[model samples]
Target: MKQKLWDHQLRARELKREALRKYGSTVCVSPCGSGKGTMIADDAIGAVSKGHTVQISVYRRILVEQIAERLQLNGIRYSVQMPDLPDKPWAIRDQHADVIVSSRDTMAAILRNGGEVRRSDLHIIDECHGFETLGYQTINKAVQPRWLLGYTATPVRPDGMGLSNRVFKSMVEAAKIEELIEKGMIVPVEVYVPVKTAKRRRSGLKISANGDPIQQWMSHAYGLRTVTFCSNIAESKMVRSEFVANGIAAEHVDANTPREEREAIFTRLLLRETLVVCNVGIADVGWDFPALECVQLLTKCGSPIAYWQKTGRVARNYLDEQKSRGVLLDHSAAMAEHGWPNLSPLWELSDREPIQKRQQERFGESAPSDAKPIICNKCGRGSIGLRNCPCGNPLFRDSQEKPETAGENLSLIGDAAEFAVGKKNYQKEWTNILYMAANHPTGSKSFAWAASIFKNKFHDWPEKFSVTPTVPFDERKRSIVEVYPQFMRRREAV
Candidate 1:
């Protein structure tokens, strides 16, 4: 069932030459349906041609079998660790196959219990993030492949580190979502942010299981072929039950879903046999179905990796011209948090957020990006260069200045003029803006202070205060104090 590889797939395979020539280890990152498994097979064939033996390690047995199938389809010689295969190597040295495909855990046991698979000339870690595991470390110590290859779409860790530091020496991006969309390789996405929370309450019409709101929205817009990420198994089952009861013919895929059942569900989805499927993070990574047109986010996740992986499910474009635009339904308001996936930046395995990466490029490694800068209120001198003031009088530490850092997306505010806070405390904010815009009586110091507060609220530049209203000062002060600190993290990207 092998087909000719596309240009990006060929280009990714070609780049592996550089991976081996320079870094010894490299991560080839591309979106799903971009032929990653094909690229891996081509890589295996290339290495085998050069008289190099290869061992491809996958995180799971399911993916290992899939990779094995690809290798076989490509006419590449391979072996595995199954009981049915009499050639399944019990000892690493006995593995003479051109390409050996096995789970990372199996390899770990082989390396630990005196087995010999690590002796290959090249090792391809399929889901290379598993490189962080002790098994990977143990195997690497045992075999130490001359050329190492890692593959991942989201190559990062939650602790603000990239995979480059551990598994791959450097990473090569095969393609971005934007690049693929432009080339018509993937579908473009439309992000929708519903204002009201999705829930089943007594605000009723005839709805199933109190889940009428989401179903109503789905019926209004979005294809029936959908995969939803829920908070937990309970939520997933509830959504599935509701959809099934409503004649959508849906099912739930959870941690407990058997491998056979999971395969059947995915096959049914591809064959257009089901309308909607709900899962508790099961489909978050590595479920590639191009027919999926809608991704319903029912659970709120803070991880950008989870957000990116979940988003990739819908944008897969197999039919090319026949594929309509992908739709994202942000029931959990995740759109407001993570932004559109295609528009999101590509992060290296060891890199932090874009702003921090820029900060490292500018401020040097000694300085941390998250560390807030100290600005002098009296002299208007900020932490960008110096700490002390030139005026001789020591500038008092003003916590009130620049309270909001940047990174919470400022683009969320659609209408800046429509924003209002009717209170005396915000009036200070308003007055400060009016003064700053005028370059006024208190000098630029007040201007800077006001702009920070303004950016925190509007998430953008302020033009004019056409109306002045009156209200309680405490609430105004409280709201400003509350909003900026939380949103400031998103401003770092700017």
Candidate 2:
């Protein structure tokens, strides 16, 4: 049975055909979970129907198997070319098959070893962001197919190199992220950044020193199936251990984990037996789990490609009625550095300058000048280009006074005599102050910090009042704590 193509997929096919006619080879850029594999299968099937051979190359053995499954479902006869493993009944080595699904390393080795190389009418490269590698270049030189197609969610490279004149001469862009979300092809993401800054390593890579990941998960995405991308194997294991210690079921997997063991862990994750999977590099590409509701980035992503791929894990729509959207808990400040996931930059088929040079030439700073994210203090939601946060809180104020001066000049709503006369009103005011402290962006402040602020204002401790925090209704109270830094400085002094 042939799978039906969506409207966008059909349009992409037309664009790819036109590109191939003009340039002989083109890269197709589409969002993750937008059925790139389906398009690949469709193209392969079309070529096979015309009595032409097709060669599909992937970076990972797992992807080879996945592509094979898609070909099988489409009723296309194919053979697999992986490195190791005994010959199976389903995956037999056949050089004469109409479609050959192969790992890039295996194909490169075949060409290097002077093994049999089958010529194909169509060549499809999966995860084609890595097309600039020497291995892929070697395979291309050997096979030299009639029409070449490369597919990836991210077309740009981490090193700012271009693929235009090198290999792919043209690019076919598919649906935008916002269009996919509107059409219900992918879920919208709600991104949240911790209220703390990232620490710089000696190598210049930033590692998040934000608040505890487990606590953040508990507050934002508790009981939701999640995948945590860690910086290293040790960090991944530590994160898994912390999650397990906090009574959340979690499993850790890295490149070294055995194939069978990794499969078992993934099965448990799909079965909901495990709530979270902390992985390093394994779940970054081509690993699909539609039920994932949350993505926690404990790893700092230096490349925008990596940042998009890591966050795309949770963008797939789930069938559960309760799962309406995806949540991104960005502890590494990736959101702050790379803007939102849905904002698309103008992709080109030309060489890109280094990030520092680009930033310096454009903004005169090393940081991204456009779409600077501002986190809402009330809900901790990160957004860009919005006057008010989605939680209905004002993200910015109209005042032009400096924060130091703002704090020094402002006092409570009432005089000291009125504050003394009404103890009930004083306690209400104290509750509002504690609320602002708890919701501060520099990570939640301690109760002692709030108590100090209360004492500084009322000339006494708030022991008689309830310690519970509530949102302050008065605009002055909210601005004094958030806009003015004197409250934070006072806490440090105390």
TM-score of each: 0.62, 0.72
The C-alpha RMSD of each candidate to the native structure, in angstroms, is 17.2, 12.5
The local distance difference test score of each candidate is 0.57, 0.67
Expressed as tens digits, the lDDT of each residue in 290-404 for candidate 2 is: 8887888887777867878889988888765434467777775555455455544456677755332342232222435333434445544334456765446687523212211
Name the top lDDT candidate.
2
Residue lDDT tens for model 1, 399-463: 42532212111111111111222211344445434332233222222334444445434333334
Check candidate 2 and list the clashing pairs.
Answer: none
Collision count of model 2: 0
Query: Model 1, stretches more than 4 Å misplaced?
Result: 1-3, 60-62, 83-94, 105-116, 133-135, 195-213, 220-223, 352-494
Error of model 1, residue 461, in angstroms: 36
